[model samples]
Target chain A: MISQNSQTILNVQNLHANTQNTEILKGINLTVKSGEIHAIMGLNGSGKSTLAKVLAGHPDYEITQGSIQFDQQDLLALDSEERAQAGVFLAFQYPIEIPGVANSQFLRLAYNTIQSKRGNDELDPLEFDDFVREKMKLLEMNPDFLDRSVNEGFSGGEKKRNEILQMALLEPKLGVLDETDSGLDIDALKIVAKGVNHLSNEHNAMILITHYQRLLDHIVPDYVHVMESGRIIKTGGKELALELEKHGYDWLHDNLQNNAGATA
Target chain B: MNALANIDYLSSLLQTLSTQNPGDFPKDLLPENNFPWLKQLRTQAIDQAGQFKWPTTRDEEWRFTDISPLSTLTFKPAQPGNSPALADVSPFFIEEANNRLVFVDGFFTPELSNVNHKNQLVVGNLAELATSHSDVIEHHLGQHFKSQKNLFSALNTAFLKDCAVIIAPQNTVITQPVHILYIATQAETTHYPRCLVVGQTNSQATVIEDYIALQKPANSSYITNSVAEFSLAANAQIRHFRIQRENSSAFHLANCAVSLDYASRYQAVSVTLGASISRYNLDIGLRAEAAECIIDGLALISSDQLADTHTCIDHLQPNCVSHQQHKCIADEGAHAVFNGKIIVRPDAQRTDSSQSSRNLLLSNQAKIDAKPQLEIFADDVKCAHGATVGQLDNEEIFYLKSRGIPELTARNLLTYAFGAEILNRISIASLKHTLEQIVLNQTQHH
Candidate 1:
């Protein structure tokens, strides 16, 4: 629910990126305002995740043209970790396993890193442990999850929950969640959605890149953007997802062809 | 490798070693040592040393390792000098261990040792218990090693003056670990540190064999040719920890052979951290039915150093199990080699064995050669072997960097974690904590 005086958190102007001599994100233009949720729904290989990674300053992607503005700063000028410290967070689709590093250690490092970047005092282990446990309760996470290795033997749902837990810890300004709802059952989807919804407030924004509109029912989006072939083909309200759920994406493809025919 | 030059080096070393230099060499291997059998053993070892020329690169056994640096310097045997107080060697002591045998320059220093003789455990040097434990010593001491076969093993036995010996009697269970501390003091000297531990039937004991230098010199050069043999009788359980942290300029060559009898279990961990050029040969034999052996090793080397580990797990009888994991981490022009061979003999049916060698290279100049060989003669045996040589995973680095952690700290954390897998297996709390900190400090250094 965005008010009239809401500030702009993320603004992408014709962002073009390449990786391994292949252009992935071509001319992606969008604006995410504070206190709003935008769902970028697309099929596989439609560059939905690529846009998320590009916004997060992933090293593999080289921004060939255009720019991204986060909190009025040039996001492209920062490194990946610098971008993360600057409040641009990308929840990975598949979290990596770092053996011998406890989940609690990794989470606290992430939390304190961003906390100190924001000129806030860092919490000790005991204080951070208590704070993180309170956040973990939002996703119905077991306390034992902190003792194990980071995503080493976690189930698919547990790995996604850990990503959301990171989002809740860092409290990023713009959260670009790439395929967060891919590997979750209905119950896990509700729990993760509850956590994400609890984290969303009037000051931070979220761009959820998902394949299905089922996630939109739990955490309603303010706007829905349909992407095709590395570009957003259409932008509509939350009711558009309901239309797409009733009629498959082929309906939009045929409708786009008809509209182009009529306009020509 | 010039064949003629290698032969000359071998022959000269053999000549220097086989000839009796009574006045110059330490008196430990003298002709008149009171025990006629000990004299016979030393002479036999010398004759065997003559037969084995120095191993050249042409030898299939030492293909990846070139130890020609050892032949450049003339060597002198180490002598027992001034006795240091307990405070001098306390830094390397294990607080949990009750029995400690400190060997300075390969000679047993009884003044520095603390042995509890009333705990059904017998601990002494070779000369002290040579008569009382002569039956066990004569049967197992020199008989276990490949004296007639390997060059380093033969030299170690021929110069065996004083050896740290531990005997766990039948049905006796020694609770705390017995620390065998071997300290090398002088540079340009050759020292032979020997150890023989025997566990009788149904006996159990844990022993830590530590090798260190008294001084920390960047240019110190010494030769420590060590040999330790362990014989475990039926239903015996022996856990051995061998740590070699000599000076950075020292050449540490060692051979450890463990023989496990029927239903016995042997768990051994060997860590090699500091050495200019070092080679450790571990040969474990599961002699009888239901014998099991678990072997773990780590060789962390950096900066022009070379560390080589060759292990052979021989499964001699039926119903045996052997698991071996060896890891090597090399950085900044260091080279590490791991050759793990698992042999399942013909009669060793139902033998389950697996061996893995994981090597990590931190720089472009770092080199690693990991070779896992399996020779299974029994058709029904289960054997698995693999070798991996790689750098840190980029995805893991990206994962860490994405969490706002700097790239350098991420790399250091991952590097420490790689070596921590083996350090986690250590049982002694103090030793394990010390090693963990050492691994974190050394492996994570920029």
Candidate 2:
């Protein structure tokens, strides 16, 4: 558990969610605080991505029994856009292709929408172009990217970089990167990690959901949590990620079963 | 009941009138003129119009649109009134359109029109052309289009008293577009707005035909039946755009026919945004080898409005190419229909043609009917056609919402994107922007 004195950005208690009546997240309990970077690692079908989607208020999942608090507000009660405006940002693993809409226009609309919600003056197209270009430099994206359609025909690495670029512009209080490192090469992973690191601050928090420990090498996390069967089974320092990477999740499964037997 | 549900209303009224034993030519609608040839042409058209029945849902082409509301209405011929207070015409008037011909209530409005460089081209009334250029008008008018299968066109030709006529001479290049605007005013009246364009050999021209209403009429509905004919000579190039922005209560039917000579290039774009019940028929004929034609259309309708577009391209000679794409957006019980056909003659070998119809339904109640047909008799011809009808992908909607756009705004953006695909292809920048704004406005309601 994170310290009580620290400002908790997100708190999930016994969260249960499913789609089409098939339960995915059985009982997810986690706490993320400001200034902390948490890495959630799990094997396939372990509800890792589901946790991220559920946090973003995706309508596909039905929360049977749970409660989520973000910045001390009832996050679960808000819709997806409301949650987004409330400073909860999720960098999707698969960014959708929106044809016929310029990327710059989409980014400006999204930026202005969040800015207005924060009671800040929104930037127009010219100002936004200047601001977004500066951020694109951090990700080493080409200037032509702003002219193309949103994520249309973008390479996998380019899509990941685009997600991070959006995060840089949005500057949300709590950002969740779901499998952002899954499809990146080493070079793209470094650039993406650097972008995420540059955006991180003491006033904000981040949760990186990945299957590999490779991303942890670049964007180091303070806490590493292992999720299996929709629940966080173990929590440790960043060293745990390396150990899990070397030993695999089978060790943790055995350890979890043995501990349950001993307790029973 | 909604307008589309009672589809045969106006047709039934016309049927009643025809059964009452009145003469074939409705006396009040006929013109008293000196041109014997013109009078004979109208008489023949009226006789033909009475022989064919109004299309109903039973007809395969009109399966999705029900025109009962139009058929039941009792409408007289539209009469020109004191040019009513002008509605803002800035948006519809393109700056690049140097020569503009404005018609109000099917009558020419001289004060509202401006034609520059009179010596470069001939711009006059179609009726006047019967006297000034009778040989050309007699040879081209209503010759390319088969009016026996088209009732509205037959009605238009039968009452063709006034029309905007444009003639571009040989080897001339008109830099600016010739804009023909037909503004329908008054209610419970039918208007026949017509246009004839002739592009001579190796000439280049662009023509824009716009149909609009100053305001939505109260307590009554009007109808505008328009016919535009284009005759492009060998090696001539003509870019044509037709915009229909009538009042939602008005009924609009238009027929555009284009005849291309050897190696001529023709492009036609239609943007329909208004009218309660609207139908546009576009036909293009490639009479010589190497002729090319492109037809594109966009329709945005909601609130029980119904818009139908039917297009046909005939490949009469060898080595011709035609491409057609039509898009429709329907919401709130609105219905849209798109039917496209391509016919390749046996001698038209190596002819290339492709047609596509894409529709987006904004609501569960919104519906779209799309049919793309190809009939090829040439052994070496290549042709393909496709049609799709669907709603915005739920995943895409969710994706937008997750980025802080509200569901409604996200849906609007997606819908605009869907329609913008066609509008973005417009060669005229100002027209593209204006049409995009209209499509954006349509997205807000659904």
Q: Which one is best on lDDT? A: 1
Interface RMSD, candidates in the order listed: 1.3, 0.9
User: In model 1 chain B, where is the ten-residue run with the lowest total lDDT?
Assistant: B1-10
Tens-digit lDDT track of model 2 for B1-446? 12322435435434533454324435233244566777787777777666656788998777877886777676766766536454455556788888988888888777788877565888877655567788888888888786324777887876666888898889999878889989887777788899999999999999999998875444357899999899999999999988898888889988888999999999888888889999998888999999999888999899889999988899989999999889999888899998898899999999999888889987899888888878888899888888889888888888888889999889889999988877766778898888888888778754
Candidate 2 local lDDT, A152-252, one digit each (tens): 89999999999999899889999999999988999999999999999998889999999999999999999999988888889999999999988899988
> What is every candidate's C-alpha DockQ against the true complex, given to 2 decimals?
0.55, 0.56
Give one digit per residue, the lDDT tens place, for model 1 in B1-446. Answer: 12323454344545565575666555553344577788788778777776665776899889999998887666667777746667878988999899999999998888889998878899988888888899998899878765224877877877778898899999999879999999888877788899999999999999999998875454578889999999999999999998989888889999889888999999988999988999999998898999999999999999999999999889889999999999999999999999998888999999989888989998899999888888888999888888889988888888887878888888888888788778767899999988888898986755
CA displacement after TM-score superposition, residue B320 of candidate 2 (Å)? 5.3
Worst 10 residues of 2 chain B by lDDT: B1-10
Reference-based lDDT, residue B252, model 1: 92
Q: What share of the reference contacts survives in each candidate?
A: 0.58, 0.71
